[model samples]
Each structure stands twice: as structure tokens, then as C-alpha cells.
Target chain A: MTSASVDESTRLAMYRDMVRARDFEQRAYDLFLEGVVQGTTHLGLGQEAVAAGFAAAMRPTDMTFCTYRGHNHTLLRGAPMPALMGELAGRKTGICGGKGGSMHLTDVPNHAMGSYAIVGAHLPIAVGAAWAGVLRGTDQVSVCFFGDGATNIGAFHEAVNLAAVWKVPVVFVCENNLYMEYTPIGDVIAVEHPAADRASAYGLESIIVDGNDVEAVHDIAVETIERARRGEGPSLVEAKTYRHKGHSRADPGKYRPDDEVAAWLERDPLTISRRRLEADGVAGDTIDAIEAESMIEVDSATEATRNAPPPDPATLMTEVWADGGSEWRN
Target chain B: MAELTYRAAVARGIAQEMERDPNVVLIGEDVAAAGGVFKTTEGLFERFGPNRVRDTPISEEAIIGAIMGAAMNGLRPIGELMFSDFLATCWDIVANQIAKTRYMTGGQVALPLVIRTANGGGNRFGGQHAQSVENWAMAVPGLKVVAPSTPSDVIGLMAAAVRDPNPVVFFEHKKLFAAKQEVPEGEIVDRLGAATIRNPGSDVTIVALAAMVSVAEEAAVVLAASGVSAEVIDLRTLVPLDTKTLLESVSRTGRLVTVEENPRLCGWGAEITSIVVEEGFWHLDAPIVRVTTPHIPLPAAAELEDLAIPSSEQVVAAVQRME
Candidate 1:
């Protein structure tokens, strides 16, 4: 159920990515508390396995679109941690020059193509990117990540059906984290499996995985993404996961029953991945070294972000048009 | 030069761009097989085939989203919305996603895309189908707006819109589709935000767009018979608005009157009025006049719609009132 059939290198890399994502998110949350990160930030603390597994499976040419809780996904895709933190801190050295802030971190060169703040906006957008593959004769698949909440939105249905109709290469991953915001997802959605139950509506197979387990998530990602690259159209994979923190800076997450919270925390992605690595006969020294390296990387990123200057006022008026100016009239 | 119907010019414009660049593709409802709801896209599917010219279900969101995504990647795509009024259904994608993606992504992505929609009334499409929505795009930042009145301008501005590195909302007036004009031969490329003086005069400036341009010309003739020399300026684009032409025309005429199919109250005419009053304040002999349809939904009844929309007679009457 864990990293049993996976190779030592693959398992190690998966564990390392998950640890890096966890460490970076933890540091970002701390920065938010210290008032370094202005505005609201949605941290993907307990959902690193989904981001790490999907990133590991995806190729460099492949593109990804995620929600506001997207720091883990962006960093796992090889975006420089300093820039990601810098963007969160509203610094000039940020990936988006601090204009996009935490929710809109984008590194198109690294294939982490834009995080959307609006809910359900990126589902169809990712489908559009995949449509480029179909038109241009490429196998580059586009991956879209969202929560169980997004599955009920109009864009999710439109995007899935259109991707099926056009046979575009895209994978829609729904991280069913049990809660939409303060309410449980099961309370709102009519179906049992939020995404997988609706897959049949678009003529796709229902695939549900243990999102807390890195190997399971990676295996599903590799399969569906490959299916898309092969021109087999789109697939919807629902990963059952949980958010360890509240929805945003404003939420204290008191609505969640204590037992449910304790149960999900017990299956934290980093802990699951590391325990699996140790069970696979990997040395404790090797496992400990990866965690230590991730800590050092996140620490330096935090330091660099704090020291960086805020974006110049000139950046405020730039990038409205591709001509490199916001000016509309001559 | 040859005479080309405004509808035929739509197909010709798309074909010319698609011929020049392999990246240019067309997507929308009935665009591929049925040649668009207005039949403006005839022969495109046949010429470009299914690869370049694709059709979709009535999924407006998907169509818009597909073009935005393609533009982000490599292809220069064009989406033919059946009607401009349908922009309401997918306003989120058009206004939020396509308009803001480049700016939000910090300009890493270039959205060289065009959304061509049939705009304005004449066929009496009721309130839902008939609307001059260039104002809708004009109100939003990060979107380029273009509305060509004549077939010649259509072929020219369509080329410019497709070539632009930003998202452009192209308003093709449905009423002008049947009208014909002499289009010059070979590769007509016109710049956006450039105003063309259709009929130059001195006494009063008549600013018009799309269907209203011809109406303005008709009123200019009636005004000429009455000794009021009215200048007719066709504003081809709205976002990169031809403010210089507007100010220059208003300065020369000492009076500004705008003719538009959009209802009054916050129409593009209001913005032009604000600009004229702000910049050309000293040049005014009287308050700026706006000859527009009363701010109400266009009725389904023929007589009601015709009476509600501004006419050449109304333009003449408004000019007379100004006198």
C-alpha cells in the first residue's frame, strides 16, 4: 500500500519532495503569523503527498494549475523556494514580482503555470492548455488540481466534458480534503466520492486513492497522466486527504470534531512517506538527512525573503499588456 | 478594389490570418459545420479543416477557456461567439480569466487571442440576442476592444486584432453583415485605436461607431442641407480609444454629438463625453449631445425596437435641438 513496489530512488525522491513541501508550507504559515506575509494565505500543510506524487510523475514540459492553497504544488514543481517565499512576503524578488502575492504564485518557466485565486477558474483553463497539445501534435499533458468544493462548480463540469469531447491531454485531480471551508464536503455534495462519482458523467473511469500515501498517489498520477499523453483524453482522480490547518488566516477550524482532526493528523503525508521509506529498509541516517536538508532549504528561503525589498512602485503599473506597459492610449 | 459584403469579409479576414500563420485556429458553436450562427464564418471549416477550424457544444465557458489556454501555450486562436449578448453566460472566463491571466501571471504568458462575436441589432433578436457589447469589454481593463463599421475596416482591423499580443474583444455588428463596401486588394492591415474621418466637416463633430457610423453619415447629409457642417469620425476601437482624434474633432467643431446603438447611461458615449468635457472644455459652444437608444432592453416587437433604437432622423433631430 506504500512504497512496496517502487524503486529506491523513486521512493527517496518522493519522500524528499513531500518533506520539502511540508517544510516550506510550515515556514510560510510561521511567516504569516509574524506579519511578514500580508493578506490571507491558504497553506497545503497536510496535502503534500498529492503535490509531491503528482510533481514526481509529471514531466518538465507538462504544465500544472492549482488553487490558492497551492504553495506545496508550486514548490514541488521546482520553483525556487526563495522566490515562492518572496512572493508570499510581497518582496521584489518574488516570482511574480510580488504583484500576484501568495495565492497567484506562478513560475511558467518551471512548468508551475499560475495559481488561480478564483475557485473553479483553472479547470477549464488547464483544459485549454491541454487543447494546445491536441492542436500542435504534442504529448505534453496539462494537470489541474482543486478541492472537493470545486467539483460542484460550473467550470469543473464544463472543463471535464469538453476535455472528453476534444480528447485533450489533461488530468483533473480533486484533493477531497473533507471540508469545503467550515462545512464538511459530504454535507453539500450529493455523491459519495466527490470527483470519482462524477467521472462517469464525462465517460471517464472513477479512480479514488489514499492521498495520505505517497506511492498510491504517484501510481495514480503516472497512470492517468500517461493515459492523457497517449491521447486517451482526460481522467478525474479523487484523492481522499485532509487539511491540517484552518481554511485561511481568518479560520480557527473549531467546527471540525476533535476525533476527525486527530484521525487525519495521524496519517500526515510526510510521516506516511518517511515511515514507508524506513519500512522499505532505507537507513534512518538517509531519511533523517533529507528532512534536515529540507529544513535548511526552507530556513534560507525565509531569511532571503525577509531581507528582500518590497516591489518597486514602477512594478505596480507594469505588465497590464504584453507590450510591457499599462498604457492603453498612444 | 472589389466589393465585399461585411459577412463575407468576416470569413475572408479569418482566412487571410489563418493562411498567413499556421497558429491561427477558429473555435465556437456551429463555426466549423454550420459556418457560424450568423453565417459569417462560411468556408473556414472547409478551408482550414477540422484541425484549425473546430466546433464545440453550446459550452461558452469551454470555448473561451480553450482559446485562452491555447493563446498561453503557442497557438494564436480565435473564438466566434454566436452573439455578443451571450458574453453574459461566460463573463467570468472572458472578464476574469482571459482579461487578467497575463497580468496575474506577471506577463510571462502572451494571450494573443481574439473573441469575435456578432453584436448589435437589426434583425430584431429581442433583448437577449441583440446588444452592442463593445462597451462591456471597454469597461474592463486588460482587454482591447474593436468595432469596425465597414467591410474594408473589418478586414483591416480583424488582421490587427489577431496579430495583437493581448486579448481583443472584436464586436462585429450583425446589422452591418449585409452591407457591402469596396475593400482594397491584398493584405489589408489596419492599426487599432486609429480613428478614420469618414466625412470631414467643421461646424459640429458627430462621433459614431459600428452601425451608428452610417447613421451619422446620413444625418451629416441632412445637416449639410440645413447649413450645419457636421464632421463624422468613425471610432474603430474603444480600449485604445482614439482620444486624440476625439479631442481634435471636438476642438475643430466646438460641439460633440455621439451616435451609438448601446443604450444611454454609462455607454462608451458617456466616457467620451467625460473626456471631451475634461480635455476639450474650452472648445465647447454647447453641452455635448448623446444621440442614443433610451436605457432599456430592446423590445421583441419590430415597431417598438425600431422606435427605441436611435435613427438617422433622431440624429438629425438631436443636431437640430443642439442648434
Candidate 2:
């Protein structure tokens, strides 16, 4: 029922984040096609609103654990553009110091623990982090972001059960983009609405919102995050979103129908958010300036990362063990 | 030197570590006021308080998962699963997460965690509690598995494992916990992945681990009286196995006898025997003799349990077969 007390500048900031995520992903996809980036990528093309909404509501002190399609999550969690671009370019200045590629990006200082490649593996990990925060009497809430495919995993069930039993302050954000890779969720599970039905099974409150609407998604996230900080236990917020690109770099998404894609494209999150600002009496020049500034920032980061050095061969064995003052391996 | 039981040395090591590091904490069922099912964690709760020595619910998966999370946030957690056989309940956490986290993450993080559990089948705790499951952990890539046989070895290995960066699985023999030995007075640290020669001889080489080490040593004396000198090598750690010492001993003796308290099929003894055969193939005079438990579940009765596990008589017989 509550909405965020957003000002003109705050709305523009949210718009810029969405634009940056969208633009960076598009450019990365182009580079991936040209053989500049080596590995396959799962771009966050149409899911910018989910990241922008949640990241806008959360504090830098709060922790976030994400899945493979997590480039936007890392950027929204305050990972510098240079470091993020360096990781994609496989440079030493990357967030994981060029160790982790696109699938595993981490910036611990920003409280964004790396994304896990395994399906549903990070669920129990996030639950444990939230439990630690609660035991330490810290009001810091941990956010776990996963796709609809992860819901079918056993680790997801075990993690949700533990989180519910302990009443740990965590937000389980499921970015339900209708299709889990190629198989639609409707064909897999018997339940009509995945999050609404499953959340109640674990004794948690559920909220289903229009994920394409940035203002609505942001307001709902802010409320749920506050509830968690007040020790009111965990909540499941299922953002009904869609992806414009294929599952990975190789997939052309021929499995999905053309009319379905067109229908969702008409309700794009970025277009809707800007139109809402215009209707609310916001000036047009301010919005255009924000978009221009974000493009310049993204271009600078891309150039810096390309020029950064590759990781040293000797650095491979550094983080394997702690410096315990004993030369056991040498 | 001071005389201390193997169990006492292990308990002292844990208590000393907890007292030294504020980040070090222990979690297991019956580890608190009950002082662990084997009394290894005795008086720790009184000294360190409940926060440090926590009694977790009977969920092995949760215990390991929680420790992994704590370790990620700069806390050193020691989780105890009462028996090695019960590790099956949390195999996913151990195999998938704990073992592969470092490699899959491209070495971005180090798991500073220890899982201490009792293994080997000498006690009459039946099939559920008595089992030697060290080989399962040995098959895993990233985990470091260590099994110590004596009081002094237990103290040194425990301290080393606590300070190790990678996740270590410390397997303690339930039968050897009450056995007394001369231990060093101060704190001692031993390097892992090294084998110790308990008894030296020139006729034949007998390789053993955990509770079987004592039996191998006893059999060596019996073999000497019969004019068949047998050397005994205690494989202290299983994963980073001491193939160098094992092959060297076999090269000198030209014969081998592998002894273990676990089942014969695919046991840790099989791994050691394979290494000797592959590395020291030309040095072998006869086929490698394996003295191990029958391929069956451990029995509950004292008499049946004694028959199920390998003894000194079996080791002596195996040495004679090599002749």
C-alpha cells in the first residue's frame, strides 16, 4: 500500500540505472558476437526493472546473492563500471580480479557476494548469511535473486524451509520471465502462479507485481525490505518480467512465438517509466541529460577494461589458502 | 613428554584452539553440555560459553551449510558430525558445495572449515554407527582427508587442520580414543600428506591406517619372532596420500601387505595397494596381500564385531601368505 517518497532526481537516477544496464548488456552481446568476449553470456535485456527496483530500495550495507544472469545485479549493487567491464574483457582489474568470468561476478565491499553457476546452490548460502546477520543483531537484510527454473530444485525448498523456520530477514526475489530457458513454467509445474502458491507453503508472505512497471516494483521492494529490517521475517516477491534476448549467446530463441515477444515488448519497463515521469510534470531536458551521462560513463568503462592487463600466472595459487604463517606448501 | 589418552589430546587441542582464537567456534549435536557423544568436547561449553560451543539440531546439512556461511564471513567454524557414516545425510553440502566451491569459483575464496567425525568399525555400535567411510571423501577432489592413529598424532593433526585454509575432513578412530600414548607437552604441528614408519624392518612392508596401524605394528612383532621381518607404515592422511614413503618401503622390502578395518572392496587399502603396484611394480616379489574386513555390514554383538574387523592375527596371516 505504501509508495516510495521519490523526488525528481531520484526518479532520474533509477531511469539512468535501467538505461545503463540495458545499454551495457546490448554492447556486451555485440562484443560476444564478434568473438571479443570468449564465453557465452546470459544478458539481462528486458529484466532491468527488477534489478533497478530492488537495488534502488536496498542500502549498500545489505548483502545480495545472485545467479548466472547477474550482470545487472552486480552493476546495480554498486560494482564500478570499470571493474565490471574488465571482468567481461577478462582483464586483471575485474571485480574477481579476472578470476570469475560473466557467470561469477563478486564485489564483497559492496556486499554483493558472487553469483553462483549451479542451479539453486546459492539459496542455502543466502539463507545462512541472513541467519548470521540476525544472530549478530544486525538489521542488514540479505537479498537472493534467482530465475523461475531454480524453484524446481531441491536446495531451493530446503533453503526456503530453513529461512521460514528461523525467520531470517531475507527477500527471495524470483524474476519470473515466463520461460525457464526454453520450457515454459506452466508445462513443468501444476501450480498456476509459482510464487504466490509456493510462498504460502513455507509460511511466508507473497507479493506479485507488474515487473515491467519500475515505480510499482520499486515501491513494493521498499516496503518488503523495511518489513525485513524490522524483524518481521522473510517475504517472497515474484516480479513477472520477460527477457528480450535468447537464453544464451548461441540461442536465437526460435522456441518462443513472435506474437508473445511482441506483446511483452509493447510494455517495456524503460519506456513506461519515462512516460510516467512526463505525466507527473517532470521536465523533458532533465531526463535526456541523464541518459546522455549514463552512455558516456558506460563507454569510458568499456575502454578502460579493454586496456587493463590480464591476470598474472603466479597469482593462481594465492587465494587457495590463508597466510597462516606456516610454509607448509613451499 | 606427558602420558595422555588419544581422546584427551584431541579434547585439549580443541579447547586450546577455542581459547586462542575468538573467531573459532564449534557446532555439533551433543557438543555442548553433553560434551559430545564421545566426550571429546568435555568442559568446552563451560569455558567458551554457548555462543562458541553451540549444540546444533540433528540436521547434518544445516550444520555444514551454516559453517560454510560463517567461514565465508571470516569466522573459523569447526563442525562435528557424530559418526562418519552419518555424512551421507549431508553429502550434497560436502561433495557439491564444500568440495567444489574453490575450484568452481576459480579460487576466489578459501573455505577455512573442519569437519571432525569418528570412523572405522571396531566398536559394537552396529552397521548404523560403525563404518569406515574415508574412501568416499578421498574420491573427492578439493577436500583434504586426514586420519590420525595415536594420541600425539591426534593433537598435532587437529591443530594443523584448524589452521589449514582448505576444508579438512578429520577422521578419528573410535577405538583408539581411549588408547594411551606418550604425547609432547606443548602444542605440536605436523605437516599433512606425510606417512610415518611406526616399526622398521627389512623382510616385508605392512601399510595400515587409523585403528589398523596398531594391529599392523603388533603383527610386525609376531612376524619378527617367526624370522619374517615386517616394516609398518602408518598412513596418517588419506587424500594427499604419502605415496613416496609407501613406495620406498615396498622397494626396500620387495613385498607388501595392506591392512584396514573397513570392507575390502574399493577400501582405502585398495587405493594404497594400487599406488604400490603402479609405482613399485618391479620391486614386488609376490602379489600384494590385503588383510581387511569382509564385504558386509558390521555386526552388533561383541564376538561378531571382533570377527568383522581385521585383527593382528589377520595381519600376521597376510604376512605369512606373502612368503
* TM-score of each model, in listed order: 0.99, 0.85
Error of 1 at A115 (Å): 0.8
Local distance difference test, candidate 2: 0.82
Residue-level lDDT tens digits of model 1 in B1-323: 88899999999999999999999999999999889888899999998899899988888888898899888889999998899998998899999888887777778788999999999987877999987778889988899999999998899999999999999999999999999988887998889989989999998999999999999999999999999899999999997988998899888989989998898878999999998999899999998899888899988788998998889999888888884
For candidate 2, write residues B1-323 as lDDT tens digits. 88999888778888777777777789888999999989888999998997778876676776777677667666678999999998898887888778766644455566788999988777788999998888888877678888999988897888888887788899999998899987767767787788999999998999988899999999998989999888999988886678888888989999999888778789888887877778799999999988888999999999999988889998898778775
Q: Which candidate is the best by DockQ?
A: 1
- lDDT, candidate 1, at B187: 92
Whose lDDT is greatest here?
Answer: 1
Q: By DockQ thresholds, what CAPRI class is model 2?
A: acceptable
lDDT of 2 by residue, A1-330 (tens): 222367667677788999999988887887787765658788889999999988999988888889889999999889888888777777777777666788888777788876877777777777767766765666788888998888887767777776677677888888899888888987887797677668988888768988888777888788888988888878888999999988888788888899999998998899988888888877889888888888898889878876788877666654433442212211
Taking every candidate in turn, the Cα RMSD to the unseen true structure, in Å, is 1.1, 4.0
Which stretches in model 1 have alpha-carbon errors above 4 Å?
none
